[model samples]
Target: MSNFSSDGFDLDAISTQDNSDVIYEVGGGATVIQNEEPAMKEVEPSFNTSEHDQCEEFKKQGNEQFKIGNYLEAFDLYTEAIEACPSKFTGEEILRLKDEFDEKQRSEALQRSRLSEERRRKKEDEKKNGVSSSQPPESSKPQPFKTFELSQEDKNDKLAVYYCNRAATLQHMEKYNDALKDCDVSALLNPKYTKAFVRRSAAHERLEDTEAALKDAKAALELDPRNATIRKTVARLEKIEAERLEKLKEETMGKLKDLGNSLLGNFGLSLDNFQAVQDPKTGSYNIAFNQNK
Candidate 1:
Protein backbone atom coordinates (compact mmCIF):
# COMPACT_ATOMS: atom_id res chain seq x y z
CA MET A 1 0.00 0.00 0.00
CA SER A 2 1.12 3.53 -0.61
CA ASN A 3 1.89 5.73 2.40
CA PHE A 4 -1.42 7.10 3.78
CA SER A 5 -1.91 9.94 6.27
CA SER A 6 -3.18 9.04 9.72
CA ASP A 7 -5.78 11.78 9.47
CA GLY A 8 -9.05 11.22 7.64
CA PHE A 9 -9.06 11.56 3.89
CA ASP A 10 -10.68 14.60 2.20
CA LEU A 11 -14.09 12.87 1.89
CA ASP A 12 -16.06 16.15 1.74
CA ALA A 13 -14.03 17.39 -1.26
CA ILE A 14 -14.44 14.03 -3.06
CA SER A 15 -18.20 13.93 -2.36
CA THR A 16 -18.61 17.50 -3.58
CA GLN A 17 -16.80 16.77 -6.84
CA ASP A 18 -18.95 17.39 -9.96
CA ASN A 19 -19.91 13.97 -11.40
CA SER A 20 -21.52 15.24 -14.59
CA ASP A 21 -19.67 12.76 -16.84
CA VAL A 22 -18.82 10.13 -14.23
CA ILE A 23 -19.65 6.50 -15.14
CA TYR A 24 -19.55 3.41 -12.94
CA GLU A 25 -19.33 -0.19 -14.02
CA VAL A 26 -22.12 -2.28 -12.58
CA GLY A 27 -22.92 -5.83 -13.85
CA GLY A 28 -20.65 -5.28 -16.95
CA GLY A 29 -22.68 -2.15 -17.94
CA ALA A 30 -21.81 1.49 -17.52
CA THR A 31 -24.22 3.59 -15.47
CA VAL A 32 -23.78 7.29 -16.34
CA ILE A 33 -24.76 10.17 -14.06
CA GLN A 34 -26.94 12.41 -16.12
CA ASN A 35 -26.97 16.20 -15.69
CA GLU A 36 -30.50 16.30 -17.04
CA GLU A 37 -33.32 17.82 -14.96
CA PRO A 38 -35.81 15.55 -13.24
CA ALA A 39 -39.02 14.76 -15.10
CA MET A 40 -41.87 17.02 -13.88
CA LYS A 41 -45.37 15.71 -13.34
CA GLU A 42 -48.19 17.05 -15.53
CA VAL A 43 -50.51 18.80 -13.11
CA GLU A 44 -54.17 18.18 -13.75
CA PRO A 45 -56.83 20.74 -13.03
CA SER A 46 -58.72 20.23 -9.76
CA PHE A 47 -62.43 19.63 -10.03
CA ASN A 48 -62.94 20.15 -6.31
CA THR A 49 -63.57 23.89 -6.64
CA SER A 50 -65.64 25.15 -9.57
CA GLU A 51 -68.05 27.88 -10.58
CA HIS A 52 -70.98 25.68 -9.61
CA ASP A 53 -69.61 25.38 -6.11
CA GLN A 54 -69.06 29.11 -5.91
CA CYS A 55 -72.57 29.72 -7.10
CA GLU A 56 -73.99 27.40 -4.47
CA GLU A 57 -71.95 29.08 -1.77
CA PHE A 58 -73.17 32.48 -2.85
CA LYS A 59 -76.71 31.26 -2.95
CA LYS A 60 -76.42 29.98 0.61
CA GLN A 61 -75.07 33.33 1.75
CA GLY A 62 -77.90 35.09 -0.03
CA ASN A 63 -80.44 32.89 1.67
CA GLU A 64 -78.95 33.75 5.03
CA GLN A 65 -79.14 37.44 4.24
CA PHE A 66 -82.70 37.07 3.02
CA LYS A 67 -83.75 35.37 6.24
CA ILE A 68 -82.52 38.36 8.23
CA GLY A 69 -84.41 40.76 5.93
CA ASN A 70 -81.24 42.24 4.47
CA TYR A 71 -82.83 42.29 1.09
CA LEU A 72 -80.19 44.50 -0.52
CA GLU A 73 -77.36 42.30 0.61
CA ALA A 74 -79.31 39.20 -0.38
CA PHE A 75 -79.94 40.70 -3.81
CA ASP A 76 -76.25 41.45 -4.29
CA LEU A 77 -75.18 37.97 -3.23
CA TYR A 78 -77.79 36.37 -5.49
CA THR A 79 -76.60 38.53 -8.36
CA GLU A 80 -73.04 37.42 -7.73
CA ALA A 81 -74.19 33.81 -7.70
CA ILE A 82 -75.92 34.32 -11.02
CA GLU A 83 -72.76 35.84 -12.47
CA ALA A 84 -70.62 32.99 -11.18
CA CYS A 85 -72.88 30.31 -12.57
CA PRO A 86 -74.94 31.74 -15.38
CA SER A 87 -76.31 28.30 -16.14
CA LYS A 88 -78.05 28.34 -12.75
CA PHE A 89 -79.89 31.50 -13.78
CA THR A 90 -80.91 30.52 -17.32
CA GLY A 91 -84.46 29.57 -16.33
CA GLU A 92 -86.17 32.33 -18.30
CA GLU A 93 -84.11 31.82 -21.42
CA ILE A 94 -84.52 28.08 -21.21
CA LEU A 95 -88.29 28.36 -20.95
CA ARG A 96 -88.45 30.84 -23.80
CA LEU A 97 -86.30 28.63 -26.03
CA LYS A 98 -88.33 25.58 -25.07
CA ASP A 99 -91.55 27.35 -26.02
CA GLU A 100 -90.06 28.43 -29.33
CA PHE A 101 -88.84 24.91 -30.04
CA ASP A 102 -92.19 23.39 -29.16
CA GLU A 103 -93.98 25.78 -31.47
CA LYS A 104 -91.57 24.96 -34.28
CA GLN A 105 -92.02 21.25 -33.73
CA ARG A 106 -95.80 21.60 -33.79
CA SER A 107 -95.63 23.61 -36.99
CA GLU A 108 -93.34 21.07 -38.62
CA ALA A 109 -95.55 18.19 -37.56
CA LEU A 110 -98.62 19.89 -39.00
CA GLN A 111 -96.79 20.62 -42.21
CA ARG A 112 -95.67 17.02 -42.55
CA SER A 113 -99.20 15.78 -41.92
CA ARG A 114 -100.57 18.10 -44.57
CA LEU A 115 -97.87 17.09 -47.03
CA SER A 116 -98.62 13.39 -46.48
CA GLU A 117 -102.31 14.03 -46.99
CA GLU A 118 -101.64 15.91 -50.20
CA ARG A 119 -99.43 13.09 -51.46
CA ARG A 120 -102.12 10.56 -50.67
CA ARG A 121 -104.71 12.64 -52.53
CA LYS A 122 -102.39 12.91 -55.54
CA LYS A 123 -101.80 9.16 -55.47
CA GLU A 124 -105.55 8.52 -55.45
CA ASP A 125 -106.02 10.87 -58.39
CA GLU A 126 -103.24 9.18 -60.33
CA LYS A 127 -104.74 5.72 -59.66
CA LYS A 128 -108.13 6.86 -60.95
CA ASN A 129 -106.41 8.12 -64.12
CA GLY A 130 -104.64 4.74 -64.49
CA VAL A 131 -101.27 6.50 -64.28
CA SER A 132 -98.38 5.01 -62.36
CA SER A 133 -96.71 7.26 -59.80
CA SER A 134 -93.33 8.57 -60.87
CA GLN A 135 -90.59 8.78 -58.28
CA PRO A 136 -88.97 12.19 -58.02
CA PRO A 137 -85.26 12.29 -58.72
CA GLU A 138 -83.34 12.58 -55.48
CA SER A 139 -80.91 15.40 -55.04
CA SER A 140 -78.60 15.53 -52.07
CA LYS A 141 -79.67 13.37 -49.10
CA PRO A 142 -82.22 15.02 -46.83
CA GLN A 143 -80.76 16.69 -43.84
CA PRO A 144 -81.60 15.06 -40.50
CA PHE A 145 -84.21 16.74 -38.37
CA LYS A 146 -82.58 18.91 -35.81
CA THR A 147 -83.30 17.89 -32.24
CA PHE A 148 -83.63 20.37 -29.38
CA GLU A 149 -82.14 19.10 -26.17
CA LEU A 150 -82.24 20.98 -22.85
CA SER A 151 -78.96 20.58 -21.05
CA GLN A 152 -78.98 19.75 -17.34
CA GLU A 153 -77.81 23.26 -16.56
CA ASP A 154 -80.78 24.86 -18.30
CA LYS A 155 -83.36 22.83 -16.41
CA ASN A 156 -82.03 23.44 -12.92
CA ASP A 157 -84.69 23.94 -10.21
CA LYS A 158 -82.24 25.95 -8.12
CA LEU A 159 -82.39 28.63 -10.81
CA ALA A 160 -86.12 28.94 -10.35
CA VAL A 161 -85.74 29.07 -6.60
CA TYR A 162 -83.20 31.85 -6.91
CA TYR A 163 -85.47 33.82 -9.20
CA CYS A 164 -88.35 33.36 -6.80
CA ASN A 165 -86.24 34.49 -3.89
CA ARG A 166 -85.08 37.53 -5.79
CA ALA A 167 -88.66 38.33 -6.69
CA ALA A 168 -89.64 38.20 -3.03
CA THR A 169 -86.81 40.56 -2.19
CA LEU A 170 -87.92 42.92 -4.95
CA GLN A 171 -91.44 42.85 -3.62
CA HIS A 172 -90.15 43.80 -0.19
CA MET A 173 -88.23 46.67 -1.71
CA GLU A 174 -91.46 47.86 -3.43
CA LYS A 175 -90.06 47.30 -6.89
CA TYR A 176 -93.36 45.85 -8.01
CA ASN A 177 -92.86 45.76 -11.77
CA ASP A 178 -89.39 44.29 -11.52
CA ALA A 179 -90.66 41.86 -8.90
CA LEU A 180 -93.50 40.87 -11.21
CA LYS A 181 -91.07 40.22 -14.05
CA ASP A 182 -88.86 38.05 -11.85
CA CYS A 183 -91.93 36.24 -10.53
CA ASP A 184 -92.99 35.56 -14.08
CA VAL A 185 -89.57 34.10 -14.79
CA SER A 186 -89.75 31.96 -11.66
CA ALA A 187 -93.22 30.75 -12.57
CA LEU A 188 -92.13 29.97 -16.09
CA LEU A 189 -89.22 28.01 -14.70
CA ASN A 190 -91.21 26.07 -12.13
CA PRO A 191 -94.94 26.35 -12.69
CA LYS A 192 -95.74 24.18 -9.71
CA TYR A 193 -93.88 26.41 -7.26
CA THR A 194 -96.62 27.85 -5.03
CA LYS A 195 -94.29 30.38 -3.39
CA ALA A 196 -93.50 31.86 -6.78
CA PHE A 197 -97.19 32.25 -7.52
CA VAL A 198 -97.77 33.83 -4.15
CA ARG A 199 -94.91 36.26 -4.65
CA ARG A 200 -96.18 37.12 -8.13
CA SER A 201 -99.65 37.72 -6.77
CA ALA A 202 -98.24 40.09 -4.18
CA ALA A 203 -96.28 41.90 -6.90
CA HIS A 204 -99.40 42.18 -9.04
CA GLU A 205 -101.32 43.46 -6.07
CA ARG A 206 -98.73 46.14 -5.43
CA LEU A 207 -98.84 47.15 -9.09
CA GLU A 208 -102.66 47.47 -8.87
CA ASP A 209 -103.16 44.59 -11.23
CA THR A 210 -105.95 43.09 -9.18
CA GLU A 211 -107.10 40.76 -11.93
CA ALA A 212 -103.62 39.32 -12.35
CA ALA A 213 -103.23 39.09 -8.60
CA LEU A 214 -106.50 37.24 -8.32
CA LYS A 215 -105.48 34.89 -11.06
CA ASP A 216 -102.15 34.12 -9.43
CA ALA A 217 -103.73 33.76 -6.00
CA LYS A 218 -106.28 31.34 -7.36
CA ALA A 219 -103.51 29.38 -9.04
CA ALA A 220 -101.62 29.19 -5.77
CA LEU A 221 -104.73 28.04 -4.01
CA GLU A 222 -105.20 25.35 -6.60
CA LEU A 223 -101.68 24.17 -5.98
CA ASP A 224 -102.10 24.17 -2.22
CA PRO A 225 -105.74 24.06 -1.25
CA ARG A 226 -105.04 23.78 2.43
CA ASN A 227 -102.96 26.94 2.59
CA ALA A 228 -105.17 29.41 4.39
CA THR A 229 -102.88 32.30 3.51
CA ILE A 230 -103.43 31.72 -0.19
CA ARG A 231 -107.14 31.37 0.35
CA LYS A 232 -107.17 34.70 2.18
CA THR A 233 -105.08 36.23 -0.58
CA VAL A 234 -107.58 35.02 -3.15
CA ALA A 235 -110.45 36.56 -1.21
CA ARG A 236 -108.62 39.86 -0.76
CA LEU A 237 -107.64 39.92 -4.43
CA GLU A 238 -111.20 39.19 -5.49
CA LYS A 239 -112.47 42.09 -3.41
CA ILE A 240 -109.74 44.30 -4.85
CA GLU A 241 -110.59 43.21 -8.37
CA ALA A 242 -114.26 44.00 -7.80
CA GLU A 243 -113.37 47.43 -6.51
CA ARG A 244 -111.06 48.03 -9.45
CA LEU A 245 -113.78 47.07 -11.95
CA GLU A 246 -116.26 49.34 -10.20
CA LYS A 247 -113.78 52.22 -10.29
CA LEU A 248 -113.08 51.57 -13.98
CA LYS A 249 -116.79 51.56 -14.76
CA GLU A 250 -117.27 54.87 -12.96
CA GLU A 251 -114.33 56.39 -14.80
CA THR A 252 -115.67 55.21 -18.17
CA MET A 253 -119.14 56.66 -17.41
CA GLY A 254 -117.56 59.95 -16.34
CA LYS A 255 -115.57 60.12 -19.59
CA LEU A 256 -118.65 59.35 -21.66
CA LYS A 257 -120.65 62.00 -19.79
CA ASP A 258 -117.90 64.57 -20.39
CA LEU A 259 -117.83 63.67 -24.09
CA GLY A 260 -121.61 63.97 -24.38
CA ASN A 261 -121.59 67.33 -22.59
CA SER A 262 -118.90 68.65 -24.91
CA LEU A 263 -120.86 67.56 -28.01
CA LEU A 264 -124.08 69.09 -26.63
CA GLY A 265 -122.22 72.36 -25.83
CA ASN A 266 -121.09 72.54 -29.48
CA PHE A 267 -124.75 72.21 -30.55
CA GLY A 268 -125.89 75.08 -28.28
CA LEU A 269 -127.38 72.47 -25.97
CA SER A 270 -126.34 70.79 -22.76
CA LEU A 271 -127.31 67.94 -20.43
CA ASP A 272 -129.20 70.59 -18.38
CA ASN A 273 -131.68 70.90 -21.33
CA PHE A 274 -132.85 67.30 -20.71
CA GLN A 275 -135.31 66.12 -18.04
CA ALA A 276 -136.32 62.59 -17.07
CA VAL A 277 -139.41 61.46 -15.13
CA GLN A 278 -139.16 58.03 -13.65
CA ASP A 279 -142.23 55.82 -13.28
CA PRO A 280 -141.68 53.51 -10.36
CA LYS A 281 -144.37 50.99 -11.39
CA THR A 282 -143.03 50.57 -14.92
CA GLY A 283 -139.42 50.98 -13.88
CA SER A 284 -138.98 53.33 -16.84
CA TYR A 285 -137.97 56.94 -17.32
CA ASN A 286 -139.64 59.27 -19.79
CA ILE A 287 -137.28 61.89 -21.24
CA ALA A 288 -138.31 65.33 -22.43
CA PHE A 289 -136.48 68.34 -23.81
CA ASN A 290 -136.98 71.42 -21.60
CA GLN A 291 -137.65 74.54 -23.59
CA ASN A 292 -137.73 76.63 -20.36
CA LYS A 293 -134.52 78.16 -19.03
Candidate 2:
Protein backbone atom coordinates (compact mmCIF):
# COMPACT_ATOMS: atom_id res chain seq x y z
CA MET A 1 0.00 0.00 0.00
CA SER A 2 1.12 3.58 -0.79
CA ASN A 3 1.15 6.09 2.05
CA PHE A 4 -0.54 9.47 1.42
CA SER A 5 1.34 12.80 1.74
CA SER A 6 0.49 16.51 1.42
CA ASP A 7 1.83 16.71 -2.15
CA GLY A 8 0.81 13.17 -3.03
CA PHE A 9 1.97 9.63 -2.22
CA ASP A 10 5.52 9.22 -0.82
CA LEU A 11 7.65 8.72 -3.93
CA ASP A 12 10.65 7.57 -1.85
CA ALA A 13 8.74 4.56 -0.43
CA ILE A 14 7.52 3.61 -3.92
CA SER A 15 11.14 3.54 -5.24
CA THR A 16 12.08 0.86 -2.57
CA GLN A 17 9.05 -1.33 -3.38
CA ASP A 18 8.95 -4.10 -5.96
CA ASN A 19 6.12 -2.30 -7.77
CA SER A 20 8.24 0.74 -8.60
CA ASP A 21 6.91 0.90 -12.15
CA VAL A 22 3.32 1.25 -10.87
CA ILE A 23 3.86 4.85 -9.67
CA TYR A 24 6.01 7.72 -10.95
CA GLU A 25 5.92 11.53 -11.09
CA VAL A 26 5.84 13.19 -14.49
CA GLY A 27 7.81 16.36 -15.43
CA GLY A 28 6.51 19.95 -15.82
CA GLY A 29 4.91 19.90 -12.34
CA ALA A 30 2.37 17.28 -13.47
CA THR A 31 2.25 14.20 -11.23
CA VAL A 32 0.50 10.98 -12.37
CA ILE A 33 -0.01 8.24 -9.82
CA GLN A 34 -1.10 4.83 -10.96
CA ASN A 35 -3.14 2.92 -8.40
CA GLU A 36 -5.48 -0.05 -8.20
CA GLU A 37 -8.53 2.23 -8.45
CA PRO A 38 -9.53 5.16 -10.65
CA ALA A 39 -9.22 8.61 -9.10
CA MET A 40 -12.41 10.52 -8.35
CA LYS A 41 -12.74 14.09 -9.55
CA GLU A 42 -13.75 16.55 -6.87
CA VAL A 43 -16.89 18.60 -7.48
CA GLU A 44 -16.77 22.19 -6.32
CA PRO A 45 -19.64 23.44 -4.17
CA SER A 46 -22.18 25.35 -6.24
CA PHE A 47 -23.21 27.86 -3.55
CA ASN A 48 -21.40 29.87 -0.90
CA THR A 49 -22.79 28.96 2.50
CA SER A 50 -21.83 32.28 4.07
CA GLU A 51 -23.57 34.27 1.35
CA HIS A 52 -26.66 32.07 1.52
CA ASP A 53 -26.91 32.58 5.26
CA GLN A 54 -26.49 36.33 4.92
CA CYS A 55 -29.26 36.40 2.32
CA GLU A 56 -31.57 34.46 4.63
CA GLU A 57 -30.86 36.84 7.50
CA PHE A 58 -31.76 39.81 5.36
CA LYS A 59 -34.94 38.12 4.19
CA LYS A 60 -36.01 37.42 7.76
CA GLN A 61 -35.43 41.05 8.70
CA GLY A 62 -37.48 42.12 5.72
CA ASN A 63 -40.33 39.84 6.77
CA GLU A 64 -40.35 41.39 10.24
CA GLN A 65 -40.48 44.87 8.79
CA PHE A 66 -43.33 43.84 6.46
CA LYS A 67 -45.38 42.45 9.34
CA ILE A 68 -45.24 45.83 11.09
CA GLY A 69 -46.47 47.68 7.97
CA ASN A 70 -43.08 49.23 7.26
CA TYR A 71 -43.27 48.39 3.58
CA LEU A 72 -40.54 50.76 2.41
CA GLU A 73 -38.05 49.40 4.89
CA ALA A 74 -39.05 45.89 4.00
CA PHE A 75 -38.51 46.58 0.33
CA ASP A 76 -35.01 47.84 0.99
CA LEU A 77 -34.10 44.80 3.07
CA TYR A 78 -35.52 42.41 0.48
CA THR A 79 -33.47 44.17 -2.16
CA GLU A 80 -30.36 43.66 -0.05
CA ALA A 81 -31.19 39.98 0.25
CA ILE A 82 -31.58 39.69 -3.48
CA GLU A 83 -28.24 41.41 -4.04
CA ALA A 84 -26.51 39.14 -1.52
CA CYS A 85 -28.08 35.94 -2.85
CA PRO A 86 -25.96 33.32 -4.61
CA SER A 87 -25.27 33.88 -8.27
CA LYS A 88 -26.63 31.25 -10.65
CA PHE A 89 -24.40 28.39 -11.84
CA THR A 90 -23.93 27.59 -15.48
CA GLY A 91 -22.48 24.92 -17.81
CA GLU A 92 -21.23 21.76 -16.10
CA GLU A 93 -21.66 23.20 -12.60
CA ILE A 94 -25.39 23.70 -13.12
CA LEU A 95 -25.80 20.26 -14.65
CA ARG A 96 -24.07 18.62 -11.68
CA LEU A 97 -26.22 20.56 -9.21
CA LYS A 98 -29.35 19.54 -11.11
CA ASP A 99 -28.34 15.88 -10.91
CA GLU A 100 -27.79 16.20 -7.18
CA PHE A 101 -31.11 18.00 -6.77
CA ASP A 102 -32.92 15.24 -8.65
CA GLU A 103 -31.28 12.56 -6.47
CA LYS A 104 -32.22 14.40 -3.27
CA GLN A 105 -35.80 14.83 -4.54
CA ARG A 106 -36.06 11.08 -5.17
CA SER A 107 -34.75 10.36 -1.70
CA GLU A 108 -37.24 12.79 -0.19
CA ALA A 109 -40.08 11.14 -2.10
CA LEU A 110 -39.10 7.74 -0.79
CA GLN A 111 -38.96 9.08 2.76
CA ARG A 112 -42.39 10.71 2.37
CA SER A 113 -43.87 7.43 1.11
CA ARG A 114 -42.42 5.56 4.08
CA LEU A 115 -43.81 8.16 6.49
CA SER A 116 -47.24 7.93 4.86
CA GLU A 117 -47.17 4.15 5.18
CA GLU A 118 -46.31 4.42 8.86
CA ARG A 119 -49.18 6.89 9.43
CA ARG A 120 -51.62 4.55 7.67
CA ARG A 121 -50.47 1.67 9.84
CA LYS A 122 -50.96 3.75 12.96
CA LYS A 123 -54.48 4.66 11.86
CA GLU A 124 -55.30 1.00 11.21
CA ASP A 125 -54.07 0.07 14.69
CA GLU A 126 -56.21 2.79 16.23
CA LYS A 127 -59.25 1.59 14.29
CA LYS A 128 -58.72 -2.01 15.46
CA ASN A 129 -58.57 -0.83 19.10
CA GLY A 130 -61.76 1.21 18.62
CA VAL A 131 -60.03 4.15 20.27
CA SER A 132 -59.01 7.43 18.60
CA SER A 133 -55.56 8.65 19.53
CA SER A 134 -55.33 12.20 20.79
CA GLN A 135 -51.99 12.61 19.08
CA PRO A 136 -51.85 14.96 16.13
CA PRO A 137 -51.36 13.60 12.62
CA GLU A 138 -47.78 13.34 11.44
CA SER A 139 -46.84 16.19 9.11
CA SER A 140 -46.56 15.07 5.49
CA LYS A 141 -44.06 17.78 4.64
CA PRO A 142 -40.82 16.37 3.19
CA GLN A 143 -37.74 17.95 4.68
CA PRO A 144 -34.38 17.82 2.95
CA PHE A 145 -31.99 15.52 4.77
CA LYS A 146 -29.39 18.12 5.74
CA THR A 147 -29.91 21.56 7.28
CA PHE A 148 -26.50 23.25 7.36
CA GLU A 149 -25.64 22.56 3.75
CA LEU A 150 -27.58 24.79 1.39
CA SER A 151 -28.07 23.36 -2.08
CA GLN A 152 -27.96 25.54 -5.23
CA GLU A 153 -31.65 24.78 -5.83
CA ASP A 154 -32.51 25.95 -2.31
CA LYS A 155 -30.65 29.21 -2.83
CA ASN A 156 -32.57 29.73 -6.08
CA ASP A 157 -35.81 29.23 -4.22
CA LYS A 158 -34.81 31.77 -1.58
CA LEU A 159 -33.90 34.32 -4.24
CA ALA A 160 -37.29 33.80 -5.87
CA VAL A 161 -39.04 34.35 -2.54
CA TYR A 162 -37.07 37.50 -1.87
CA TYR A 163 -38.23 38.92 -5.16
CA CYS A 164 -41.82 38.00 -4.36
CA ASN A 165 -41.57 39.69 -0.97
CA ARG A 166 -40.18 42.84 -2.51
CA ALA A 167 -43.05 42.81 -4.97
CA ALA A 168 -45.50 42.70 -2.11
CA THR A 169 -43.75 45.62 -0.47
CA LEU A 170 -43.91 47.62 -3.66
CA GLN A 171 -47.62 46.89 -3.90
CA HIS A 172 -48.10 48.36 -0.45
CA MET A 173 -46.09 51.42 -1.52
CA GLU A 174 -48.56 51.92 -4.37
CA LYS A 175 -45.90 51.31 -7.00
CA TYR A 176 -47.92 49.00 -9.17
CA ASN A 177 -45.64 49.05 -12.24
CA ASP A 178 -42.50 48.32 -10.22
CA ALA A 179 -44.35 45.60 -8.36
CA LEU A 180 -45.30 43.97 -11.65
CA LYS A 181 -41.66 43.85 -12.73
CA ASP A 182 -40.53 42.11 -9.56
CA CYS A 183 -43.47 39.71 -9.81
CA ASP A 184 -42.24 38.84 -13.31
CA VAL A 185 -38.80 37.93 -11.97
CA SER A 186 -40.28 35.84 -9.14
CA ALA A 187 -42.54 33.93 -11.52
CA LEU A 188 -39.67 33.33 -13.92
CA LEU A 189 -37.50 32.00 -11.10
CA ASN A 190 -40.23 29.71 -9.72
CA PRO A 191 -43.04 29.17 -12.18
CA LYS A 192 -45.16 27.22 -9.69
CA TYR A 193 -45.07 29.89 -7.00
CA THR A 194 -48.72 30.94 -6.46
CA LYS A 195 -47.92 34.21 -4.69
CA ALA A 196 -46.09 35.56 -7.75
CA PHE A 197 -49.21 35.09 -9.85
CA VAL A 198 -51.37 36.68 -7.17
CA ARG A 199 -49.11 39.70 -6.84
CA ARG A 200 -48.96 40.18 -10.59
CA SER A 201 -52.73 39.95 -10.77
CA ALA A 202 -53.09 42.67 -8.19
CA ALA A 203 -50.62 44.89 -10.06
CA HIS A 204 -52.54 44.42 -13.29
CA GLU A 205 -55.81 45.19 -11.56
CA ARG A 206 -54.37 48.35 -10.08
CA LEU A 207 -53.27 49.43 -13.55
CA GLU A 208 -56.85 48.87 -14.82
CA ASP A 209 -55.79 45.99 -17.10
CA THR A 210 -58.75 43.86 -16.18
CA GLU A 211 -58.12 41.19 -18.83
CA ALA A 212 -54.52 40.62 -17.76
CA ALA A 213 -55.53 40.74 -14.10
CA LEU A 214 -58.21 38.12 -14.65
CA LYS A 215 -55.79 35.84 -16.46
CA ASP A 216 -53.22 35.95 -13.64
CA ALA A 217 -55.93 35.58 -10.97
CA LYS A 218 -57.15 32.45 -12.74
CA ALA A 219 -53.60 31.12 -12.91
CA ALA A 220 -53.15 31.62 -9.17
CA LEU A 221 -56.51 29.98 -8.43
CA GLU A 222 -55.52 26.99 -10.58
CA LEU A 223 -52.35 26.50 -8.55
CA ASP A 224 -54.12 26.68 -5.17
CA PRO A 225 -57.68 25.46 -5.52
CA ARG A 226 -58.34 25.30 -1.78
CA ASN A 227 -57.17 28.85 -1.01
CA ALA A 228 -60.33 30.74 -0.16
CA THR A 229 -58.72 34.15 -0.77
CA ILE A 230 -57.52 33.16 -4.23
CA ARG A 231 -60.90 31.65 -5.14
CA LYS A 232 -62.63 34.87 -4.05
CA THR A 233 -60.13 36.95 -6.04
CA VAL A 234 -60.80 34.85 -9.14
CA ALA A 235 -64.53 35.35 -8.79
CA ARG A 236 -64.14 39.10 -8.22
CA LEU A 237 -61.81 39.50 -11.20
CA GLU A 238 -64.22 37.57 -13.42
CA LYS A 239 -67.06 39.91 -12.51
CA ILE A 240 -64.87 42.99 -12.99
CA GLU A 241 -63.71 41.68 -16.36
CA ALA A 242 -67.29 41.14 -17.55
CA GLU A 243 -68.35 44.60 -16.43
CA ARG A 244 -65.27 46.17 -18.01
CA LEU A 245 -65.95 44.49 -21.35
CA GLU A 246 -69.55 45.76 -21.27
CA LYS A 247 -68.38 49.31 -20.51
CA LEU A 248 -65.81 49.14 -23.34
CA LYS A 249 -68.51 47.91 -25.75
CA GLU A 250 -70.81 50.76 -24.78
CA GLU A 251 -68.03 53.34 -25.25
CA THR A 252 -67.09 51.92 -28.65
CA MET A 253 -70.71 51.89 -29.87
CA GLY A 254 -71.17 55.47 -28.65
CA LYS A 255 -68.12 56.57 -30.64
CA LEU A 256 -69.37 54.76 -33.75
CA LYS A 257 -72.81 56.41 -33.39
CA ASP A 258 -71.25 59.85 -33.04
CA LEU A 259 -69.18 59.33 -36.20
CA GLY A 260 -72.22 58.02 -38.09
CA ASN A 261 -74.30 61.05 -37.05
CA SER A 262 -71.59 63.41 -38.29
CA LEU A 263 -71.60 61.82 -41.78
CA LEU A 264 -75.36 61.59 -41.96
CA GLY A 265 -75.98 65.23 -40.93
CA ASN A 266 -75.49 66.29 -44.61
CA PHE A 267 -78.19 63.76 -45.74
CA GLY A 268 -80.84 64.62 -43.09
CA LEU A 269 -80.35 61.20 -41.53
CA SER A 270 -79.17 60.06 -38.10
CA LEU A 271 -78.17 56.79 -36.44
CA ASP A 272 -81.61 56.86 -34.74
CA ASN A 273 -83.21 56.42 -38.21
CA PHE A 274 -81.65 52.92 -38.41
CA GLN A 275 -82.30 50.24 -35.81
CA ALA A 276 -79.88 47.36 -35.23
CA VAL A 277 -81.54 44.02 -34.50
CA GLN A 278 -79.50 41.00 -33.29
CA ASP A 279 -80.31 37.47 -34.49
CA PRO A 280 -80.08 35.35 -31.31
CA LYS A 281 -79.22 32.10 -33.10
CA THR A 282 -76.45 33.56 -35.34
CA GLY A 283 -75.37 36.29 -32.89
CA SER A 284 -75.22 38.71 -35.82
CA TYR A 285 -76.77 42.15 -36.07
CA ASN A 286 -79.00 43.38 -38.93
CA ILE A 287 -79.56 47.12 -39.46
CA ALA A 288 -83.13 48.03 -40.54
CA PHE A 289 -83.83 51.42 -42.21
CA ASN A 290 -87.01 53.11 -41.04
CA GLN A 291 -87.76 56.43 -42.71
CA ASN A 292 -90.68 56.99 -40.30
CA LYS A 293 -88.24 57.34 -37.42
| Alpha-carbon runs more than 4 Å astray in model 1 | 1-56, 80-154, 272-293
Alpha carbon lDDT at 160, candidate 1 = 58
Question: What residue pairs are clashing in model 1?
Answer: none
Residue ranges of candidate 2 with Cα displaced over 4 Å:
1-45, 89-155, 276-287
Q: Which candidate gets the maximum lDDT versus the true structure?
A: 2
Query: What lDDT score goes with residue 166 in model 1?
Result: 71
Q: Write the per-residue lDDT of candidate 1 for residues 1-293, one digit (tens) a residue.
A: 12111111011111223533211111111112234443874332232468657877787787667656677898888777655654533545755776788789878877877777787788799999999887773333333466455543344344556676676566557677887777776666556666677767766766777898788889888987886656776787788788889999999989998888899988888777888989889989998898553
User: What is the TM-score of each predicted model, taking all chains together?
Assistant: 0.54, 0.58
Q: Please estimate how well model 1 matches the true structure, expressed as its whole-model Cα lDDT.
A: 0.63
What's model 2's lDDT at 31? 15
Weakest lDDT window of 10 consecutive positions for candidate 2:
23-32
- Report residue 200 deviation for candidate 1 (angstroms): 1.4
